[model samples]
Target: MNKKLIICALITFISLPNLADDETTLSGAELINNNCARCHNSRPVREFSISEWRVIMPHMREKAHLTGSEVKAILEFMEIASSPAQPVEVTLAKSLTVNPRDVLTRYGCQGCHQVQGAGGTLGPSLDNVISEKGRAFFLRKVKEPQFNNSSSAMPQMPITDDELEALAEFLSSI
Candidate 1:
């Protein structure tokens, strides 16, 4: 009985962090959908490039009086929403190894995204996105960001399958 209690407690503790992350992600999406649209027709994420978003977010953040987390969330959603789809490369290595953080930085993800509370405010936080959205979702988003949302402005990244897998795994662990 003591063992069972310990296991249950462990599970609960482990689960709470993920649950919090999911809530934050959802709230960010909801806030953008509900609030941004109230003032203006919610533009598709594809409406602006990442650089353009950089300029626009600060002004909008001040105007809306959005908190840091809210700004982070909005930026996160926008990064994914604005990415354009690209054809997957056929010449990738069978098991190309990669460092996810390095890849992210190399791709300038930090310019628009916040990971572990560090990065830009142009996109949503990537702290627990894999757990919240799943690896498949990240795979699709990385390869073809506009697959589900035609209006996505997220730029297509030229990454291999192995890199994608590494990134998904890294994000899941986060």
Candidate 2:
């Protein structure tokens, strides 16, 4: 009876899959692919921080309709499989100027600004303001808002002058 009990216990232990160490947990990449890759490719690992991941995961879960366990698996895979981050060139910040339309797209300027009477009414219509206001007034308003009209809810956009000028030009053209 004692020998049979020992054998049964040994068989059960051998049959069970051993989990990896608690510190360095193994991830299920196939589970991630099946669940995540259905909607969007795995974003570059460098593009997101842990905090960003936490924020984005819920939105992605809604998008992909992923369960809690699936999301955990995917996050684990990302944490374990993350490669060493590449050094971003600091000079790129000084050299690069984002296009005005891209800025508008990124910041959702049209959500408020009415270029040629097409955008939202939250703020003053930007239509013909480029031509009407002239470049100086436009630059000044963009760089330094003289007044935050209590009625108007315009968020100060963080950008450079060249970008502002480009935005002015883009708005005027529209």
Model 1: lDDT to the true structure:
0.74
Q: Taking the tens digit of each residue's C-alpha lDDT, what string does model 1 give over 1-174?
A: 556556766665654434345666677678788777788776777778878876887788877888878878777767655665443333323333478887888888878888888899877788877888877887888799799788876789998777778777777887
lDDT of 2 by residue, 24-103 (tens): 23444665567666666875655787667777887888777877876777676666556444343322232244576687
lDDT value, candidate 2, whole model: 0.65
Clashing pairs in 2: none
Assess every candidate by TM-score.
Answer: 0.43, 0.40
**Residue 27 lDDT in candidate 1:** 74
TM-score between model 2 and native: 0.40
